[model samples]
Target: MIQVLFVVLFGAVAIWFAYKVFTTASMMRSALALLFSMTAVGAMFLALQAEFLGVLQIMMMASEMVVMALFMIMYMMNPGGLAAMEMTHQKRLSIAVAVVAGLLAVGAALFGGWPLATEAVAAPAGQTRELGLEIMERSMLVFETAGVTILVAMIATTALAIRRPA
Candidate 1:
């Protein structure tokens, strides 16, 4: 009962944040809302006992997403301000196409049947901490590579965005 309630509440909050991310006029607000949504998703993963995935999601996706958004804002010279300029485009056909696509998707989902996996997806032997140790031991090179990649990407991104007169 409690778990279900938590799931429902968190799901609702995630949806709310997603809506804010899409409709909010402020770019910073949208970014913050996305962060909030991601945090909620991490919470959901934790509640489901996917502690490793939960932590990985936060570390690998949530933090990086926020950093990317911040860099984009900085590079565009927007700073902390939201872009309030209206985007002018043809919406009528797009709206119709989106509506039809949504309906088709819903209908397909309603009728589609997926076979359940016979074996339970196994959790790590000792949950998150044990998994972390295993990752450090066996996959240290992969982890270091990912970290180095992120560092290089951040430096390159910053260097490319900041122009100087020579």
Candidate 2:
């Protein structure tokens, strides 16, 4: 009962923060909202008894959010988020897309094929090894593709941000 309650609370918090992330006009505020949303997700994992994942999520998100905040401060005109402005484009279309996306996500959550844990839980070391194998084997291509994509994006961004002398 308590677990469910905590999970629901954190889920609500996450949703609220995520909404704020998109709704806020300030880049910095949006970044902070994203951080809060992810932290709430981590808290939900902890509530679900996924200690390793919870800690990893929180640590990774905290660092990533810091980096994002720094980037916004350096690159954005209004990183302090003091001025109110329209943050989104095509508001009606955006809301329509959001609704469709939300429905799809709910459908996936309800109907996705998830494997059941049939075997006994492994020891700590064994579990760590299993996680490594899963990441390195089953999800290797996805990870590698994401890494390459991120590398390319960073390079492109750096190039674009370089100031040319007049």
What is the TM-score of each predicted model, taking all chains together? 0.61, 0.71
Residues 28-124, candidate 1: write the lDDT tens digits.
7778888888888887887766877877776766777789678668765454555566543677887799789989998898888867677654565
- Tens-place lDDT digits, model 2, residues 70-138: 988898877767877655579899889989999999999889987877776665567668878988999
RMSD of each: 4.5, 3.5
How many clashes (backbone atoms < 3 Å, residues ≥3 apart in a chain or on different chains) does model 1 have? 0
Candidate 2 TM-score versus the reference: 0.71
Q: How close to the true structure is residue 146 of candidate 2, measured as C-alpha lDDT?
A: 95
Q: How high is the lDDT of residue 92 in model 1?
A: 84
Q: Candidate 2: where are CA atoms >4 Å away?
A: 108-126, 133-166
Candidate 2 local lDDT, residue 23: 79
lDDT of 2 at 99: 96
Model 2: worst 10 consecutive residues (lDDT sum):
119-128
lDDT of each: 0.77, 0.88
